[model samples]
Target: MNDSKLECLLIRIDNFSINRTEILLCIHFEISTQTMLSQSNLNLPGITQNVSKVLTIYTGGTIGMTLNENGVLAPVPGQFEPRIREDMNFHDPTYLPQEPEWLVLPSLGDEKRVLYKIKEYDPLLDSSNMERSDWKRIAQDINDEYKNYDGFVVLHGTDTLAFTSSALSFMLQNLGKPVMVTGSQIPIYQTRSDGKDNFVASLIVAGTYDIPEVCVVFNHKLLRGNRTVKVNCEALDAFNSPNYPPLATMGVSINLNEIYINRPPLIEPFSVQLSMDANVSLLRITPGMTLNQISGALSASVRGVVLQSFGAGNIPSNRDDLLTELKAAIARGVIIVNCTQCLGGSVADAYDASSEIFEMGVIFLGDITMEAAYTKLSYVLSKHAWSLQDKKDMMKTSLRGELTVKSAKLNTANRLGNVIVMEKILIQNSSVVNSAIEEAISFDQTKVIELLLKHGAQLTRPPLEVAESLCAAAARGSVKRLQSYQTAGVDLSLPDSSGRTALHMAALHNSVDVVKFLLNHVDDINQRDILGLTPLEYALRNQSTEVIMILNQAAKS
Candidate 1:
């Protein structure tokens, strides 16, 4: 359901400049959306002033409390999303209009109240009482209802809200939507409680932003769910987003932290995962938590353990039982990651006892929240029985930017290999990345082949080299310079280093030109890179998220 002419015209183009590459992008959308992937060009009008569009899911929580004549803190029927809409009607005319798609989910039935309107999912209430199945169910409903909308806002109780938020953060895999989980420090019935401002602000932010990563937008602060900790018990700014920056800070006018919002395309394919390795345990290293206790957790079929070390990731040097068990656990392939109990400080593997833990094969999660470390480790272990190599690789990589990676240089500071690879390539190609396609606009039809050939690029490599380049690009995220080698002129299928070719690199990087050149001159978008990676696989791995957003966008033209 794309209004193409309206959309293309909205981009300020009066006519289609049939480039060797652009024709492919246009064709990609026409075919993909017209066919199966359901992807389309989401070219929204540029906002001269702010307007909000949001989908609010009202899951029963303490945030909406109002007292009955009995004076109990109970949830009001449906004030979360609707209240904000009503408030905006009177006070702030500048407040953006939102296309409200609000759904009231089943409520919390405590000793005080028996609710009717609240739709109980599974009849099991407490968030700590939440199972992985419940997590998936909530996420599934959110996806089902809000996938087409701009952003999502969920009203949740603060008690175990972090768990559901964190689980949803990991569970929703590539959840490229703005989600704000907020409830009240006081119920809606309270005359002076903070729920109104918090609820209003959460919807305000959700309606205006498109942060793909899941975050808890509470009080006036935005927190990465996995990084968030409910520090304050009774303050207005009840939750603090310590490790990460707030996506937006609302004031006289909304100040958005564009740096934190999803940097790539929005309409991309996402496969949600609610499963986690349950064989994971957390060991809070208190003075009484013996080495025997540590050993026992490892012995309990725990494939991974997140060690909450004292202060700056310090474990008890005197505790031989724990050290021995930790070492033995490593030998047995159990991943031990040391995270700090302190909220602010980072984990140091360079210090005395801390440094020694490194030698025992314990991975250091510097400054990462224990929730992040635990959930991330569970994510890692659930994949495969990790080797020492895999363990080290997992620690080094960014699983949702949980840890800050240190590199030798500032510019080449590699974080997630696959994510950074082609993004960096785009930076390197900034001189011509867009211009290359832009220039192709004026070229004659026959000149497309000549211009592409003149650049010493090729259609595609043999499947083998296509695979290799895909790996290198996905891992390093930057392509080593293309070589005008002996086999440069051969069929696009010739596989190189990691079985990758030009097509593999192009699509993965969303190098529109490379993608276009391959389409116009090479064989097919359907062809795989060296490692059996398709253009789509490269898009997912490289997170060229929005590049080939219209799924069949690459293949058809």
Candidate 2:
């Protein structure tokens, strides 16, 4: 069958509650060709786009609220878009003739123009009231409209914004497009509110960048969604990613820290996992806390617990009863994840007091926030098909970049001159080699690359796809990295499956320095792609004047 028919079949299968044999029989008989044809012909969105279109899921938040009759800031549904229409910063009238309801934003200095439509929820929630069902609804909506939009923006309330972001990060798996969650401390209806800036920046980032991860864009900083926590209540900058670095910092120019951003998964198709087990709770250990409190938190219904331990994952030594209760819970199959109570730092056995807890089978999650820990446990435990041991193993793994694995060793090596630990990690897992190479290439870490090469780690070469290659990555504005590839004996003239070389990618991104560097190495400046376009043609299409000049000078030379 065709790609569209196969996609329709998957959707139909997902809608049914049938047995495996029945599903196989249905597929064998091809019983639904008429149904598939009708579904496929319903004006489904195609895969190509020239302009960016974003779907803003406006769930009720402080940004969309106004004073009700009681003079309290309450969410007023169906009123947000009208306010946006009045604000020139959000809506442009020039594109109204094309789509009356869709709001368009004028292109801002080299960024793609954004045309957005808002999907407002009925009886909008005050984020404090958001639940797991709400998270499932949002994830499902994004999946339902996945093909139509280039990216997504979720307008949420600051009260539980971190929880929502963390939940969505796990729900949306193998995401290829940007999904940005944003909110403001003040309402957009007010004159001096930060909502306008937050909302506008979110649309711009979602439209312009191909950041495949879920992110939170607040106060001009783009942070990974699962790593964020609300640090302040009244400040414009309310959220902070304490453990991870900002993906991009917005200033006079929006500077992207591309090394920290995750590339899309080249193998798996995008999917949404909406099943979340809500039978999880967080328990923070305090001084003089009784054993009954601990036992009460991990009651019969609770299947998982995120234990907030003392410094370095310690517990009170005198409380053997508390230990007994926790051990009993573990024996009863409760997954307990130990996290640090401090604002920063990982849960480790550095302290002698933490040794006993470590022996009790408590999983240590390094530097993960409480929000992430809770949601991760929920997501993991909800996998009913997986065995108990699988759930425990997954909690220790960094699936969505929520926690750092082996953080202590890496930090110690960086702080001190300890190369042995780093070398061991690199040797044990070849996957670390690719991440190491990416970092080295992006930051010009020559010594690090040399170390990896000395350890017998193979350098990644260009394959059929452009994104799969190091040269294409370098062409996005890293001349030093491109030189490193050339010095390492990599062939710079190899074209991707599309017959586009690094020079073509450099021309499209307007990387003048990269274009100049590749001119000396490439055999032909006039080499044409599968579309019969040269590097100069790509530069001309993007209006890249500097690259065009460099290519023209090279062509004549």
Candidate 3:
């Protein structure tokens, strides 16, 4: 083919992705009967499919509910079971079918069809009424049913769904089976309800995908069950899996997004704790919160208090009276948990009054979300009337994946906790990597994103840490780390903590790939860092051709 024709074809394929029709013609350039017929279906909407082997467990939701005579859109008790038995059509689950499903795709001859039968289960409820007792029962039921099915689809109410999910992530432990919870805002019977897509996608997702953990499928998004929190009370996409990436997401095809899956041994067995013992209290400090209010909440027989501290865990510095009462509460065996008032900060016990409270006996909740604090504390407190050794174990350990252990900022760290401290460890541990900055330079493609992200760049993340990684990577001249940054979406043109991009860092050290990746991504060829030296200026002054080649490529791009 001529270059022009090939380019046109490439453009067309890019614009409208190469379907089987396009693929057949591009590869063979001949029309056959099968290819032509297959092409015909590509544009068709809503084709009823034959899901021959998958099981759809309908536990009731807006998907199976309708408006009663009183006009409330509610689950019609046993309606979910009949809907499945009546062959009421729906799409397959998000992931493909499983067995007791394994990680691999089904055998080629295995049914392109689904075998959905009405689960011979009991009635479903709107999740608002879901108590911890109900959660215990649901976990038990799913555990019992897991071995016999291809996958499970739970129709849950949007409200309180997060709580049930967090519970299941811990309760079920390591499920090789895919357990999915989903629901809709509008009733499935309503003309414009999002029920069909949400329900069908979750069903297909549960059956087809290999993420073997509890998850919530809603509004075309698949959230890791433990990490997710229902943020909106009324929207269709009500949940956000805070501090975690989605395990998978729904689209034309299910996109499984998990980078890793942590599982305990199934031989370990599924046992229900059934209770948590945390008598938690939340104290919201305003301009004039006095000792009286603090004493009232702490003295009210509460075993725990989530002291909502101000900036980085600060409070009124002069209010020794309130601080004294708080200390007394701590002496009363009250587990005071200090969480920052700022949405993004932590309680340092060094800032304002927050530190004094921390000194008084409050444990740092760090950046955990407020909804999580309430539910987790409630669940923990409910485990028993008293905080036992086991209850403390739950808090320190990440039960339900709610807390971070390693003290690093999230998404940037391969693990959690203390970004600065973590970076030094990641880099210093790079015996092969030699430096933290060299975190991702090994691969030409793929894992580069994860590596560079693990190395971390900045945007509101503290500068003291970035300076350390920057100095370390620059000192080592790690090519792999540089390349990884490109894939990880680092804006190469931007300045670092010391006012240098990798360009300037490369010029100082004469790194070829580092300079090359930087120049490729940075728009300004002659850009300078805070030191006012363009990378080219440094390359020329240093007289390194390798560094010069990198600068040239960056300039050309």
Candidate 4:
């Protein structure tokens, strides 16, 4: 093909709307497919290979808006795509002319090309106008195209972006793909807009990585959607995950903090839960909050309330009327959750003023953002089939990495006060008793383990994991920790996930004291593992003569 003809075809593809019919017309040109593919002066070699598809859900945001006649910025539909297409940073016109549905982007040295299609919303809304209905719509759209795309990016206004992101985090259950929410404080049309970078980075991360989380990608940080809060109105980095770490950081390279990312559930199928009950409210407590004001905040129609309490979840303990109104709300089955008004720190019953509220059944979520608490309440309350207690329990737990769960037993251990008081607290929080027992045993806190056991906390976890815990204790030569578990009725002969007994770990780690202790408790001193190796053999292989001597003597006996 002639250079002029090739140039003509490239310009035609660039000018036209990306659709299949237009692509077919390009293919009908007299040149061969190979000839068309060879004309590449765009610095990308093999641009068609290693492609990832994303569905960009352009719900109206500051990024897509242009200034109106009144000089105020407003979202204008059908304007975003044209602007980005004109900017070569977002679209590469030379990529696969016969397949125009894929809006190809230039490779970012990661050897992956992102081909995206914009699904802009009609009658675009400022995120201030977004509600539960909007969250449901976005979630449902992602669900509908879940199979067709590698990931999703929702462009939204930064005003209520965190709330929308939080709602989507709950509504989109068992999400196995990245769903990134991002927007700019500045509009894309402006000369100094941050939208271009935010938009491009979101696309790259959503397409390139397997971070199975609902993330908010803005200002070079990928934050957990539910964990985020709009911290600053004027700054480019508007959102912050104060309690949690960002999932990925966009910089010289797209660096992912793999440990913080959620592993996609293998058992549960991806689902969209549209039934979010929006009849939830927030009550930020002040010093002089009257009974009538409290009652109005916890309205009759509201099913749940996120009480933004003072530092460390405190309330005016002297105000009997205030306490009475809160008690009345809880009595009527209102799921009241206590979240701190401070930017950082958890809502704890550390103060005397916080005690009455806790006794009255206000669930304390540690360091959870107000946006997350409110949306979580809505999500939990929407479950019509769940019992009242079950819904309340769900709120207390970190379902979507929303809160840092400070266990009741751990809290009690941190403040080792009167046994009677500790027992009362632990007894009431039975749901986390087993977990607390494990934590205590791991730390070799014998007294805490005993306290939990007295309250019916048992080693009732999955048998394989329990075995591993015992083996880990044995390997560390923590006789006290092992003794606590054994005294709590744990079978000393329990095998780990690898089918190796605690004796195997103790022998391999050269723990002579642990070896001696296990010899008296385990069913057999010479038990064979799944690999057909006995503890004596493991000790001999590891060349631990003391453990070897102990095993040899035990074998003789």
Name the best candidate (by lDDT): 4
Ranking by TM-score: 2, 4, 1, 3
Candidate 4 accuracy as lDDT: 0.81
Off by over 4 Å in 1: 1-53, 68-126, 262-268, 384-392, 407-557
Rank by lDDT, highest first. Answer: 4, 2, 3, 1
lDDT over C-alpha atoms for residue 274 of model 1: 50
The regions of model 3 sitting more than 4 angstroms off are 1-61, 84-88, 91-124, 264-267, 284-300, 307-322, 340-350, 378-390, 409-557
All candidates' lDDT scores? 0.56, 0.79, 0.58, 0.81
Clashing pairs in 2: none
Q: Write the per-residue lDDT of candidate 4 for residues 363-477, one digit (tens) a residue.
A: 9998899999999999999999999999998998879888877664555462353456657767676777777775555545566677778888887777777686687677656
What TM-score would candidate 1 get against the native?
0.60
Model 1 scores a C-alpha lDDT of: 0.56
Model 2: per-residue Cα lDDT over 437-492, one tens digit each = 54444444556666666766455644554233544464447676667666555667
Model 3 weakest lDDT span, ten residues long: 30-39
lDDT of 3 by residue, 1-557 (tens): 45775665466456554466545444332122123223212222333442323345555555677778997776666665444433335423333333322222222244234334445235576666776677777776676665445566676777777777776666665465577887788877667877877766766666555556777888888877766777777777788865666767667666664433433311123445555444566887889976678777787588777777777777787887877777887676666676666645445656655656656666776656555565566667666654555655565565555665443532344333234544565566543222323322322233433543555532333444444344335434555444454455545455543345556657756666566555555677676543345778767765777777766765675
> If scored against the real structure, what TM-score would every candidate get?
0.60, 0.76, 0.57, 0.69
Which pairs of residues collide in model 4?
none
At residue 522, give the lDDT of candidate 1: 54
Candidate 2, superposed: residue stretches over 4 Å from native? 1-50, 407-444, 455-557
The true-versus-predicted C-alpha distance at residue 14 of model 2, in Å, is 32
Per candidate, the number of residue pairs that clash is 42, 0, 52, 0
